[model samples]
Every structure is written in structure tokens, then in C-alpha cells.
Target: MISLEKDAGLWIVTIDRQDKANSLTPQMLEQLCEIAESAREAQALILTGAGRVFSAGADLEAARAGLATSPLWERLSGAIARLPGLTVAALNGTAAGGALGMVLACDLRLAVPEAKLFYPVMKLGFLPQPSDPVRLTALIGPARAKMILMAGQKIPVEEAQLWGLIDRLAPPDSLLAEARALCADTLGASPAHAAAIKAMIR
Candidate 1:
């Protein structure tokens, strides 16, 4: 489902469903939320997926099987949004649908050069969660958010960076290094001060 590796002050969380491009299941989401709740003491947090994907998005089969409103699902999405730690998404590959939503929730996002970003919730005949659209618009502006969500447009990493969806870009091979640098910078700040600044921003 998900793997957690704590390296000194940093906590690394990886989605490990490589067979399905690391698609998120309700149970996996629950585990993630639980792990994140217990990781408040960490200096920084990094999220990435196994194999080549950051995530393919929500598990559609599970959703159709009535898992969408489960407590695990809610906790997964809501907890990430409220995480007190400095969070970063290391987008190692493509991100779509709920995967894009997850990236938007993070405090910062770094994408590999070949990665792609898009939301297909509309094409799937579903509306994205309110917070997803709100956060996307906040980061990239209403117009850009509308263009992506309404049009189901897949933005390349370079374009996503230009539009402000991604904060940094790196070669696929150096993506981890870039993510590490960003995490190091974030962890340099006092956790208490970081929390205060985040609270003030909200």
C-alpha cells in the first residue's frame, strides 16, 4: 500500500503500488494519513511513488465498489491538507486525476522533466473535491485552474512550472537530489516558526 522510511529528521512516504502505477486505494490512503499524523515531529516530509509513477490517481474500481466515501478515503485527503509538517511532492512521473489533487495539497511540488500533470475528474464525469479546486486555483490562479480542469489539459512539467503548479523542475535522474535540497532548506527553519508562518498564511 504505502511505505514509510524515517531518515533522521526527514520522513519519506512512498506509494508502492507499482503494478497499477501506484494508484491510491482507500486502505492505502488510511495508512498514509495515520503515518502522517504520527510524523508531526519530523523536520520535513517527502512523498513519491514506486517505480515510475508519482500516482495514477484514485483507484476507480474501488471507487465504483463504494469506497469513495469511506473514512479511510476522507482521512487520506483531509489529513494531508492539514498536515503540520512541511510537505513536498516529488513528482517522479505522471500525475493525473486525484493524483493532481494530492500534489496541489502539498506545500511545495517538484517535478521531473518528463513528468506530466492533469486532472481527469471531469472527464470521468465526477467533480473534484472542493479543496482540490480551491488549492489549485490558489496556487495557479482561477483561469489556469479552470483551463486545466475544464479542458482536461495535460500540462508538461516545464509548462506546469511556468504556470506555477510546480515550484521546481529537474532531470528525471536528479529529481531526488532536487527534492532533497528543497527538503533540506525547509527543515532549516524552526518547526515552531514554520507552523506559525503556515498558520498566519492560512
Candidate 2:
């Protein structure tokens, strides 16, 4: 399930499938992709999940049915990356598998202190979304990216921060609040000014 909330220029998208550890279904992924693609009006976009695990990646049954290799994963991440606004991944908990694609695409990443990030595509015999490795390598470096994608290491929050994988670590209970606070300046800026700065940085 996906929950999208719009407050002025800020967009908050949440994955709301707690029972499934917030794993995404094809429909939910489509909703996310649509939201990302249509969020040109958003000055700041914060993506989060509703439970302890941000996402366990694709829904188990769906992944077994070929969802793991779907082009939707690449489409979703590409849409998020193209958003002309500040895009933040507010990781409430562990982020694994295909979920890492969107996280890597985000402009900034804020994670709970207890959160960990990993992608098991190698072990699962599936290649990651097309853009994931380039983005991940850009943030943390090719060697470190290899450690996670190739060696299958689960990167803890502190280690992640050290490697520049996550920009900040927030208290678990206040993760969203902190993520919102991080967007205050962007939220207050003119849409054109915000978009200009984002484009300049990229």
C-alpha cells in the first residue's frame, strides 16, 4: 500500500504494508513511480515506511512471480532521481533488495540509528535495478558498493554514515520529524530557486 500526503510543496510518501514488512507489490510500485514522475510541483519529497522495516523489497509472492526483475524498479528510481526537488529517503528501518534502488536515487538519505541497508540481488540471483549500482557507487564508492552488492554485507547505520551512504541518522521515533525539519529551507524556497539549486548540485 502507498500513502501520499501533500502539504503545500512538501510531499510525503509512505509504504503502509506493515504485515509484509512494507514490501512493495507491483501496484504499489506503480503508484510510487507515478507519484515520483508527477512530483515536479513538489519542492521537497520525503519517502518513508510505516513500520520497523522500511521495506524488505518486493513482496515475497510477487518477487517469486518475476517482480524481482521487473523494469518498474528502474522506472521508479529513475523518476525519483529526475524529480526537480529535494528528494529524501527517510529510512525507518532496514532497507533491502530492490528497495535499495529508490534509496540510492534519493538526493539525501536519513536513517534511524537502528537501520541497516543491504541488497541481496546477488544471492537471490537477480541483478539490481539498472541505475542502482551507479548511484550507490557515486555516494559510497565503487569498492564500498561492491562490499554490499557483491559481498552481501548488511551495512549498519554508523558504517553507512561513515561511508557517506546515509547523510544522517535520526532517532527511530523521530525519523520523519527530523526528515521534515531537514526540508524546511527547501519547503520555504521558491519552486524555481529550489529546483535551480538541486539541478546545480547534480
Candidate 3:
């Protein structure tokens, strides 16, 4: 399930199927894309999870049924990337498979100390969505991106931080608070101003 909370100019989106490690179904993925597309008026947006694991990627059944290679993953990530708001990935936990696409598109990524980062597309016999590798490489470099994308190695939060995959680490209890704090300035600024700064970096 995807839950979106709007607070004036700030929007927070959470994947809430905790019983399944937030594994995404096709409907859930579509919901996320719709939310991201509609959030252009938000001054800041935070994408996170409801439980310990941010997302285990696609639901097992869905992936096995051809959802793994769906273009919705690309559409969702692209919508987030095109947002005029400052987008933040508040990784409450590990992000695997297609789940990493949105995180890679975010303007900033802050994860809990225990979160692990990996994309097992290589092992799963599927190539990652189009922009994923390029954004990942832009953040952590080509070799490091290869370590995860090609080797399917899991990088703990500490190593992720060192390698630039994670911009900061927040304790579990304080994760959302830290995200809101990080968005404070963006929320206070005009949407145009925030978008301008974000675009300058792009």
C-alpha cells in the first residue's frame, strides 16, 4: 500500500505493506507514480517506508508474473526526478530491486543506521530500470555502482555513507524527524526558489 500525507507544501509518501516488507504490487507502484506526478506543487517531498525494511522491491508473485520488467518503475522514478520540489528519500530500511529506483532519483538520501542497499537485478535475471544505473553511478561512481548492480553485494548504511550512497544516517526513532528537519528550508522557501537550486545542481 502507498500512503501519502500532505502538509501544506510538504508531502510525505510511505509504502505501508509491512507484512510483506513493503514489497510493491502493480497497483501500489501505480499509486506511487500518481502521487509523485501530482506532487509538483509540493515544496518538498519525502519518500519512506512504514516498517523496518523500506522495501524488498516487487512482490514475489507480481515479479514472477512479469511485473519485474514493467516500465512503471521507470515512470515512477522519472516523475520523482522531474518534481519541482526538493525530493528526499528517507530510507527507513533497506531498499532492494526496483525499490532503489526512486531512492536513486531523489535529491538527497538519508537512511537509518541499519539499512542495507542493494539491487539484485543481475542475480534476478533482469536489467535495472533505465535511469537507475546512471543516477547510481552519478552518486557513488561507476565501480561502486558495479559492486552493487553487478555483484549483488549489500552495502550496510555505514559503508553506504562512506561511499556517498547515503547522505546521512539517522537513528530509527529520529528518522522522520530528521527528514522533516532537512526539508524545513525547502518548505519555507518558494517552490520556484527550491526548484531553481535543485535544477542548478542537475
Candidate 4:
């Protein structure tokens, strides 16, 4: 469900479920958590998804089956979100539901031109994790975060960037490459200094 590659002191994590728009499965999330744990020693980390989407969010069928709230998913997501290193998200396509939460947790996000983001917990008749609102507000400000949560509206890629939701933009095909380049630039600096900077920010 996921692939990990290492190059130039960076770890690239990819969700490889194109047939399902790279939707998050419990198992996939577990693997991602493991990847993030292992990334602690790396200079940087980048996550993306296969095919046209970085992630479409949770598997709805799993939710209907009562598997979405499993403890494993919660633990795994927390591990990925708090990975102790420079973390970057390569938003390769539309990111919604829990996927938006994942992107919001990253230190930096490079979104593709085709990327769109939304928080539709209201529309789904479900509330997002309480911490999501905090992270969303930290990323895009309280006003934008409340608008997304309350209105259940989708924000286009450009608008999301303008709203401070994403740090940079890349072509769909080049999103991963851009992410790698950004990580490379990060790794080019002194690792110790970077770690110190990250610690200070945290």
C-alpha cells in the first residue's frame, strides 16, 4: 500500500493505491507510521500518493463497517504527524477528509496544480478529531479553518496556497521531484543546525 525510497539523505514515502485514489486504509496507515518512525534518523521526509491523488482520505466502506475508528489508525496517524524531523507533504492531487489532516500536520506542503482541499466533516455528519481544528488554524488561520469546517467547501489549489494552506506549488507530474529538491536543499545545510532549528520551532 506504500513505498519508501531513500536518496540524498531524504526518505520519500508514497501511497501506491491508484485504483482507490490512494485512499487511507488501516494497514496503509500502519505502514506509514512505521515509515515515519524510521525517518527520525533521516535528514528529511516526503510523502505523496500514487496516480492522480495524494490521498482521497479514509475508506468510507471501512467506516461503514465500523473499522475506521480502530485504535491502530489513531496511533499510526499520531506517529506520522509527530515524526521528529523535517517533514514535507507532496500533495499530488485532491486531498480531503483525514488526508487534509495529514497534510496539515506536515511542516511544509508542496501542492500540485491539480490539488484541492476540503474539510467536509459536517457534510459527512461526523466531526473531525478535535486536534484537527487546532492544526488547521495553525496552518491557514482560524477564519479559513472555520470556513472550511463550517461550510464544507472545497478550496482550489491556488486559493489554498494563497490562504497559507500550502507552502509551494508544483506541476502534477513534478510534485514529487519538487519535494525531493526541497528536501535536498534542506539536507544541504548542516544537519545539526537544522535539527536545532526544528527543535526550537517545536
Candidate 5:
């Protein structure tokens, strides 16, 4: 369940499975990876969830059925991370579990004031994908990463922003508008320069 819309030089991608908290299935991940691969032609890309929840993470039912794995999550998130242009995660709501990987992969993250973020791998008795921990540590450092991944703590929007996990907070009603504005601000830079700087730092 994914919706892609092109607006000028921007591509907005939304997860459309609100009935399941927008939890991602293998097919959904594949689609997302495909979009990420093709988004290089756009000036920027924005990823968000349709209804309330941004993403509840991997589909547990599918995982239980042996239909999902860390590799699939890695493939999807890695694609997003490798995107040449600016990529933003517009967190309309909370993000949890493997969904955090997607949020972390984005070049910038903008969350609604009500958004919360967490990873419950330890609480769920599951080992987080190796890349997940590495990315988390790179963004917010080892201590904060430990609190989030090892302790299963819920990070509210304010703390997440202070910790550098979220770059800004927008009101729920204006989240997408804010994300677009942020993307517009980055348009002055040539895509080649931006991609080069991003690759060097990341």
C-alpha cells in the first residue's frame, strides 16, 4: 500500500494502509525500494503515512509467517539512504520498530508535534538489523541509541528533536506543507552538489 505523487520537482510518497497502522509488508517494502531507486530524477522526495500513524514497522503477521526479514528492511532503508537528492521523512504520527529505519534513512526528518518514536526490538525479543543500530548510533550517538533500541523507550517529539533525531516539528494539520517548504529551501543547491556532500558526510 503506497501512493506516489509528483509535484513539480518533488515526489511525495505515502503509506496508505491506515487500517494496519501503516505497518509495512514485504511487497510494500519492495515498492518503497523501487520508488527510492527511481526518485533520483526528482529534486526531492518526501515520505509520510496517510492516516494517523506513520508506520508501526514490519508486519508482524508476515514476519511470523516467515515472510519478512531484516534483509528486506535493510534493502528498503538502504535505498532511501542512497537517494542522491534531498529526502525527508514527514512523520505525520508515531514511528516504531523497523519503521525507525526508514525515518533514519531520510536526509532530514520532520515530525508532527504529536509524533513519538521508538524501537522495541529488545522488548519484542528480536535483534534489530545490524544496519539499524549503526544508523541510529550515527544519528544520535551510542548512548541515546542504547536508550531507544536497548531499553525500548518512547521518544516524544520534543526530545527527539533535541536529540537530533527529528529536525523540526510541525503542527499536525500543516505537516506536509512544512515538509514541502523545507524541501523548497534546499532547492538552491544543485542536486549534484547536495548528493556529493551527503555521501561524504554519510
Candidate 6:
């Protein structure tokens, strides 16, 4: 499930399936892609999760039912990455598996102090989607990326911040508020200049 809210210049997208650790289903991914496409006019966008868990990655049942595919994941990640303005991932809790791709796609990431991040593809006996490793490497470098994707390391928020996987850490209760403040600060930059910088960096 997904919920969208507009606050001033920011569009907030929340994954609301907390009962299942907010695991993403194929349908949910599709919906997110659509939302990302439509949110281009907003000055900034924030992707987060309701309750706690940001996302547990692909829903196992959907994968087992053959409803999940690398292409679908790519579409969702690509959509988020291509957003014209600033994009931020407010990691309210842990992020795992394919969910890492979504977080990486964002221009910036803020996580709660208790949040943890990992990609369990190796432990799950499958390779991460091709683009995932590439994105992770681009953000955190090959060695650390290997530690996460190949060694199946679970990184807590403090280490993640030190490694540049997350930009800031906030207390659980204030995570979203901090993310919104960051977004608001980013709005001080001209949209055109911000977009250009993001494009150049990518």
C-alpha cells in the first residue's frame, strides 16, 4: 500500500504496509513508479514508510508467485532516480534487499538512528538486480558495496552515515521532521541549478 501527501513544495510518499515490514509487491512498485512520474512538478519528494520498517525489499510471496522481476524493480528505481527535482529517502527503519536500490536512487538519504541497511541477495542465494550493485558502488564504492551485497553485511545507521550511505541520522520520533527540514533547506537552491547539479553528479 502507498500513501501520498503534498506539503508546500514537497511530495511525501509513504509505504504503508508495516504489518509486513513494508515489503514491496509488484503492484506497489508499479504504483510508486506512477507516483514518481506524476510528482515531477514538486520541488522535492520524500519517500518513507509508515509505522517503522522502510521496506523489507521485494515481497517474498510475490517473488515466489513469479510476479516480481528485475525489470519491474529497475522501472521503479529508474523512475525515482529520474525525478527532476531533489529526492530524499527518509529511512524510518531498516531497509533490506531490493529496497536498498530505492534508497540509493534518491539524491539524499536520512535515516533514524536505529535504522539498519542490508542487501541479503547473497544470503538468499540470488544475485542482486544488476543495477543495484552498480548504484551501491557509485554511492559507497566497490569495496563497501561488496561488503554489503557480497558479504551480506547489515549496516547500522551510524556506520552507514560514516560510509556515506546515509546523509544524516535522527531520532526515530523526529526522523521525518528532520527529513522535511532538509528538504526545505534544499529548496533554497534554484530548481534549475539543483537539477543540473544532480544530473552532473549522476
Of the candidates shown, which would achieve the greatest lDDT relative to the real structure? Answer: 3
Q: Model 1 Cα displacement at 191 (Å)?
A: 1.9
For the record, the alpha-carbon RMSD of candidate 2 to the native fold, in angstroms, is 0.8
Q: TM-scores, in order shown?
A: 0.90, 0.98, 0.98, 0.91, 0.93, 0.93
**Each candidate: what lDDT?**
0.80, 0.93, 0.94, 0.79, 0.87, 0.86
By lDDT, is 3 or 6 better?
A: 3
TM-score of model 5 (CA atoms):
0.93
- Tell me the tens digit of each residue's lDDT in model 3 across 1-202: 7888999998999999999999999999999989999998889999999989999999999999988999999999999999988889999999999999999999899999889999999899999998999999998899999999999999999999999989999999999999999999988888888888988987
lDDT of 5: 0.87
Which parts of model 3 are misplaced by more than 4 Å? none
lDDT (tens digit, per residue) of candidate 1 on 19-90: 998887877876777887777778778888777889887787986775543455445556666777678899
Candidate 6 lDDT, 1-202, residue by residue in tens: 8999998778999999988999989889889888988877778999999887999988999866753455777777888888878899999999988888889989899998888999887777777777788888987899999899888899998998999999998888888888888787557777787788878876
Task: Give the candidate order by descending lDDT.
Answer: 3, 2, 5, 6, 1, 4
In terms of lDDT, model 2 sits at 0.93
Off by over 4 Å in 2: none
